[model samples]
Target: MMKATPESMTDADGLEMDRCFSTRGGVAYVGLRDRWPWYTKRRSASWPFAELRVADDKIVISSMFGKYAVTRDDVASISRFGRIPALYDGFKFVIRGDYEAVVFWALWGPPVRAAFVRHGWEIVG
Candidate 1:
C-alpha cells in the first residue's frame, strides 16, 4: 500500500491540505464532500485522515485518526448530497441515502439540534 505524505494530501477543492500541527490536545473534525462520509477529523500527526481501499467485496473506508474502518456492509446508507442553507442560518440538513443508516454532524448544540429536528431529521443521542 502507498502511504500518504504531507505533500500528497489534497482537499476536495484539489488544493493541497493545510499541514498544521496540532498544538493542543484534541481532534480537528471535518466532513468530506463527494464521498460516503458524514463526519471526519484529524488529530495528532500519526492519526489517519481518510483512505479508501477495497476489502472483501465492498469498498472500505480506512480512517486514519483511529482504528476506525467502515465497509459497505457496515454502512446503512450513503449520502450523495447535503445542504445547510445559508438563509436558514443555524439550521442544517444532512441527507443520507441508506435505509436505517444515520447521519451525524459534529456540532452538538441545542440550537443546531432543534434546527435539525425542525427539518424532520431525527437527532440521535
Candidate 2:
C-alpha cells in the first residue's frame, strides 16, 4: 500500500492527498466517505480529503475510494440544520441531496438504509 508522501502527494484520482496544516479555500465535500467504502483500503482515496475547490458554487463530492464524482446540484434536500449523525466514528459527514442521496440509498447497506428510511429523507429517483 502506498502511503502519503511528498513524491506521492497526488492520488490516482487526481486529488491532493496531503493533510496539510492549512489551505486557502478548503471546505468539506460531504458524503464522500460514505460513498466509497473501499477508500481506506486503497491509496487513491487519500487525496479528496486535502483541499477541494468548490467550483461554480457547487461541491463535487468524489466517492471516498476516488472512483467517481458525485454531482452537487442534484441535491434535493439538506439536513434541517446541515447535520447528520456520525457514521465513521464521528469523522464522517452525511449530506443528503437528490441525485447523490439516491445513489447513496442504492449503495448503502442494511443499517444505513434503515437509518435513512427513519430520517424520511429519501428522494424519488
Candidate 3:
C-alpha cells in the first residue's frame, strides 16, 4: 500500500477521472464562490475556501489550497461531526483510505445527503 505522510500527501485529484469514471450529469455542489465558505478554520477542508461537488457516483471538493474526491467504493461510513457545532455541524463520509470529508447539512445539505442515499451508502449517525 502507498503510505502518505502529511507533508507529502496531497488531496485527491479528479482532473483525470473523466477517463476512468463517467463524469457526466447528476452534478450538485455548494459553497461560496467568493472565497469564504460561510465559516473559516477547518482541517479537512481546503485552506482559504472550498467547494463541494457531487456528480454521477462521485464527490469532488476543491479550493485555492487543494482538491479531494472519492467514488462510492471508497466510502465506508457517514456520521455527525460536531467539532465546531451548528455552522460546522455536518455529516462526514469516512473513506476506505483513511480519508474523510465534512459536508454541512445546512449548505444544500438535503441534496448532499440525498446523493449518498441514492447510492444506498451509509449514515452511521
Candidate 4:
C-alpha cells in the first residue's frame, strides 16, 4: 500500500500522461464506466462507458451523463478487480464519498495503472 508523498507532483502531463496512453490526444486513459441509469440501478446490466483523466488534483470521469470529479484529497485507495461480465477487469477508486467509481480496463489500462503507481497513489492488485 503505497501513499502519495508531500514531494510527489504531477509532471507537465496533468494527471495521466496522454502520450503514454493508447487513448487519443489529451486523454489519460479510456475505460468503461456506469452509463445512463448506471449499473447499480438496473435490473439488467448495461455496458460500462467512460473516460478517465486527472486534472487540477481531481480524478475526472466523463460519461454520456456528464462528468464526475473526485478530488485527489478525497481518494482513500484504488484497487484492481475482475468481477462479473467477461472482460470486466477494472479498478475501484474509493474516495470519501457515498459512492465509489469503477473504471473498466481498456487498451488504456496498463499504462494508466503504471502511471497511477508512479503517481504514488495507494494502488492494490
Distance (Å) between predicted and true CA of 84, model 3?
7.9
User: How many clashes show up per model?
Assistant: 4, 2, 0, 1
Residue-level lDDT tens digits of model 1 in 3-121: 98967885443334443111111123244455566445423221234332222223222233442323434544333223334321221222244222222222223454443344343
* Candidate 1 lDDT score relative to the true structure: 0.33
Q: How far is 75's C-alpha from truth in model 4 (Å)?
A: 1.1
In the range 14-123, model 2's lDDT, one tens digit per residue, is: 44444212122112333334455612321322322433222222323344433223234444343322223452211122344412221221111334334334434352
Give the whole-model CA lDDT for all candidates, comma-separated: 0.33, 0.31, 0.46, 0.49
Comparing 3 with 4 on TM-score, the higher-scoring candidate is: 4
Number of the top lDDT candidate: 4
lDDT at residue 77 of model 3 (Cα atoms): 56
lDDT measured at residue 117 in model 3 versus the true structure, 0 to 100: 62
Candidate 1 lDDT score at position 94 = 29
- Clash pairs, model 4 backbone: 33-49
TM-score of each: 0.24, 0.23, 0.46, 0.52
Predicted candidate 2, C-alpha RMSD: 14.2
Please list the residue runs of candidate 2 whose C-alpha ends up more than 4 Å from where it truly belongs after superposition: 1-50, 62-64, 67-73, 80-125
lDDT of 3 at 54: 56
**Tell me, what's the RMSD of every candidate?**
14.3, 14.2, 12.8, 10.2
